[model samples]
Target: MSTDTRAAAPEVRISGIDPHWWRQAAVYQIYPRSFADADGNGIGDLQGIITRVPYLAQLGIDAVWLSPFYPSALADGGYDVDDYRDVDPKIGTLEEFDQMVAALHAEGIRVVVDIVPNHSSDRHEWFRQALAAEPGSPERERYIFRDGTGPEGAEPPTDWTSIFGGPAWTRVPDGQWYLHLFAPEQPDFNWANPEVRADFLKTLRFWSDRGVDGFRIDVAHALTKDLTDPLPSEAELDAIPRDAGQHPIWDRDEVHEIYAEWRRVFDSYDPPRTAVAEAWVERHRRPRYASAEGLGQAFEFDLLTQEFDAAAFKDVVVDSLSLAAESGSSSTWVLSNHDVVRHATRYGLPPLPETVGTTEQDRKQGAAWVLAGAPEDQLDREKGERRARAATLFELALPGSAYLYQGEELGLHEVGDIPDEARQDPTFFRSPGVDKGRDGCRVPLPWSSTGLTFGFGSSSAHLPQPQWFADYAVEAQERVDGSTLEMYRAALHLRRELQTDETLEWIETGRDDVLAFRRPGGWVTVTNFGEDDAALPSGEVLLASSPLVGGRLPGATTVWLRESQS
Candidate 1:
């Protein structure tokens, strides 16, 4: 096959075709604290992101999902939002946020900010008022403040445990207890209060009016809780059943009502702004969050949680597509994010069990084992990189939208050895030696091989980068052919031109270790997960994650092929 023939795949312009571009667009997630820092403050800021708009535009992503930069005490990594209407001074001012949004718009990239509607920072004015007000006061109605049960009101209101490993209820100085599903610094809102619902709608409009495109709702499933019900014991909380019906705090049916109201607000806009829920509900219940009246999209996290196996990947993709079809919405795909270990290192770990149990102890033990085993010296870097590239090709070739984390394109591994003293993740202190937390995946990105902070900024990054990051620096990889960064750029460029808005069709290769699928445009993607090389289908190779061996797809590799017309 000639190079010209391989490069002759059809090209389609996807930008201006439909107002609902998010249905098929690829979105890049930017963790502002580690993405870039312009003012030499050692923390990434809005200006730093503005400086990189060109980089994102060239990468071919349709939108940028900015994690929470709201004013906060830095508890829970900005998820404890004190002010929803403004940006944190450490990140940038509101004026800088508007400027950044305008710059991103100029580059044809949409901006999706994170919204933490389920909780507010304890420092928030409302929470402060609630703390100062007497019991049963109106000011206390904004949050979930309950009277304790035991003598002298010393006992907690319930037996619920926090997601971060402590009691969910915190006793106030006034003999009352308050609910905080996450950290104590983040107080759960009383959604039953009309004021809370009205305020969130106002916040949504505030950003949308300023040209924000959408929102990636934080804890989308936990906003509405059944406070009337008794709290489950620690064991029951840990083993919360994954069913469609209501639970004490998660995936309650009332949560959809909040989204439905938000959807109406989205529809009120000129372009109909979009939203994606970060809901970890049962598969059957997940579709409800993306129904026609609900948010238009929700993160399908099965792909992120699955083992690096052909069968597992195939199952998640098919199931997600089916769910999207049923819900009259689009599927969203992601492999890595700020909250989890980087997929490159994760792929290097041993195969995981098919079904993880519901017990908290079981889950914690499993996670600890994975984290403890992922030391840099213990990982198979070569094999991991091969699989990571193959996985990227496989994910981007799928039908629906894809999400790329900050450093995945560089094939960066988790920084497993972050110093104990420098660690900042709440999970680290909350779990204390049992789990390492998510700082490994949140390290600052490397833009240059030689710099104070690898070109992330003039000052050292807040989170330390491993010495080996120089090998994956953007400047170094841009010059090396077949580098991971270049591979991502090429895959994204081709995805825009050759991808179709069609469902995937599996092509049987009679091999359990291989996944082969054909898209609408005579384009076929094949991934080999076996020990031996697999025979390639008869087609012109448009792209490959790794070099093919004797016209055979090598193990831990993927290839995009265009069926020959003649």
Candidate 2:
């Protein structure tokens, strides 16, 4: 018989883990628009992403989730799908997709496409026909329709609010209303229709057969929206007594059933795969998505969850991990993604002024965070690096998968501020000042110290790449051993010690500021939030983002530790 160490080896292994990895995966979300720009169409594209795959491979994540590349009208930043089969002209072509998949596979990195099946762009063929067809006809029923749907006059199916801000309903010219939990241009899908299910299943097969490894389904819980009379707000719907949305015909159970079938189908493909859900529902309902045995991984917004003070931190920690364990599920812990501001800026790291700045590309150098003596003029060289490292450590230590957004490894923070004129996000036109939406996080990635507009683009970048990024680009960090780039390498090297193939073994102790758990092969992780140290009883320091283990951590002031099994 094999020894304990050999027996602990996973049956499946990818990059030293399971063949169907992503279990303890450190997934990196790439918002293509913000990642890297290769063609210089004043926008990012597949070539840019391909050039950067090695950078990701070095970061230690098993897979990369590329947010929608399908043809879109740019509604909700590509969340509105116009065509299910092709890449957006704004990005690249089918050949580029093939090349990118090959490059990533060469590096042993799996690729997951963000699928927006819960809704479709109004320009979609089905939606166009639905608009031309009479209400309740086969085409019309492809979307959720009601003769009288709305809150008061502007109400949605429920009291639920839009995350981008405003009521969730749009009045169609037909005098009836259509449900849109997000934007008016995006129409909700009618999961009750078997045809819709078949079409989406084909969508899954379309890409999976074409070499795509897996899917990261968007707004998964929202796909199972309650069609009940109470028409509740999104949160209340989860608490509205399960049987309310449950019928032989509508809601969540069917959604789970769809995923199970999809999972089975993926298993039959060239490379067996898994599904990760963006179950962005209220706290109480997230469990249902993973509880059904349909999805392989689900995401939790808690790492992005913010508040000051230790007790408050404890509550978040306890609740976040508890929910995952309660349902026998594992979660992907995300701090910042394409949808939110970078954690460096989210934690309030201000922009470095231009004075101390280094080169033409290094406009904001050495603008590091300190308690006092704020400067009015531009900096000589700012240092936000420590704070950046702190956030990275916190994310890596938490139980389950750790999702690091692209550019984060380089300690990339929010842009220095782009004018409203250059801003391309719909949130600017739609909500204005009420919410910055996620523009701060979607700035074009910086590639070099030479400043070719965006670091990689030949012409002016499609999006504003931070001037600070060039000197701080991946290439620049690669040369310096102590750079943020190195911190990521060290962190990943340490993280590998924690098995990626095994099912995560989690123990929910108390505390929100502190998240404590043990790995499947007997490694313990203790992560502390700001204001209090995530105290581990005993163990050697396996990995840390900060120079200090107990006090202030690296960049974000976060800590990650591994103790002895005893």
Candidate 3:
């Protein structure tokens, strides 16, 4: 490993440590339940992940971010954590987790685990104790418990609604209501409580001491709430203003203190651990989460939400890079994750609305409409695949860290045909039949063309796999040249040599459809998002998302070019 440490801003570096590993590294997210299954129990586990470490190393990702594998009741897909220090019995034992970490280190891949600090599983011991204890007790004080309004306390304490659906406040037998922003199984933690803060710090040290590289802090912005202020109406919550740190429940100024202390904990380690906040705040407010004394990075989600237009992509990228530079933190780019629709299917649809509908009802309706209309026949699958490949190349070529969700390298599309009975996301259940939820993107990945579960395991998967998945299986794609899998491998391998710059220089491509930019080392990348072919710059072809049309870049394709010597 190179020991040369270059001076960067405090938010981007840790004293003498070299922070380049995470700054430009390509990290792969493994949603353990759907990644691979080893025990034939129809669920993916830590053992399954250990079995696949070599595969991840082969894919060339510098690190792997494993989603929550903690003990939980599976409510809200394990975000409700019953235990922070131990692994879920279904996943594996603590001993197995240590072994997996060692194995991944041996393969030169770091491990980042999910940490859900905003809420604990309703089944968590503290929550259980709160349930049995009287209101106003220390156990109950750990959570956001408040007295209900109206006669006999019939009304909830506030008008807030759960992000999943229904009222955010759940009334207990004692007539006091507890706040749960997500599913009722997840009771929001009261960060005001000293115990809650201390416990989470302990959880952080437990993992870091065990060799975990970092944490993807779930609901990082929602940890601190302003109870003194009136709860925002459902409408206000729906259309949250971009104003910085003024919201009652979402992104508040107090959240930084928690992260500042966490940063100190990370800095104490021999090789300081890192953290990336899964904060959904506005672009302006996101920097605070990654400020000098806070977390190292925050997810820059503009690319994930933007349309496929070149102008729009350029604007988002430029804005994100600018914001990160201001905070002295590297921007974290991600296309898709367990929460949203897969970009492959998203790109296939007609141009998305500039803003998703304001109300939850409208948003769900719009999502259902898109999913229903996005069949292979209605969508240009060939065009979608091309654009997806091009988008991946564009994202990886940028001068910052990039995240790849599992199976995206294989070009998997959203499984829109998943049976209603098989849907597991809490949003789907909370909303009844109104929304289909995110199970479409969480379906078990296909590893082989022929198997009981496509080599996911010997038994059937927890979620049904569609027959069409056979075509995109790793076995088939590995054998084909110019496949999406190969494109990803080659692009990742080449990215290491090219992504040495921390800044991006936009090259005027003249055409609105062509987005062009230059990185360090005379490397340039161009993506043609228009309907017609775009002229390529004079250079040697380093890589192309698709074959060029008569030596010209075709629409919906991206190419990496190295400036040639005269």
Cα displacement (angstroms), candidate 1, residue 169, comes to: 1.0
Which ranking of candidates, highest TM-score first? 1, 3, 2
TM match of model 1 to true structure: 0.94
lDDT of 3 by residue, 59-93 (tens): 88988999999888998888989988888889797
- Residue-wise lDDT of candidate 1 within 1-566, one digit each (tens)? 00111121122222463567888888999999999999999999999999988889888888899999988888788888988887789989877887888788777788889999999999998999898999998889999988887798799977877888788999999789999989999999999899899988988888887878889999888888777746566677657675855777788888888888999999997688899998877788888888869988888878877777889898889899999999989889898888877889878877545455323344444455567744556678788888989999999999888988999999999888889998988878888887888888899999999978999999989999988999999999985789998889989989989876758899999899999999988999999987799999999999999999898999999999998887
Instruction: Estimate the overall C-alpha local distance difference test score of candidate 3.
Output: 0.85
If scored against the real structure, what TM-score would every candidate get? 0.94, 0.78, 0.94
Quick one: how many clashes does candidate 3 have? 0
Candidate 2 global TM-score: 0.78
lDDT of 2: 0.65
Per-residue lDDT of 298 in model 2: 77
Name model 2 segments beyond 4 Å from true: 1-20, 148-163, 171-176, 226-254, 282-284, 308-321, 349-388, 500-543, 548-566
Which candidate number has the best TM-score?
A: 1
Alpha-carbon lDDT, every model: 0.85, 0.65, 0.85
Task: Tell me which of candidates 2 and 3 scores higher on TM-score.
Answer: 3
Higher-TM-score candidate of 1 and 3: 1
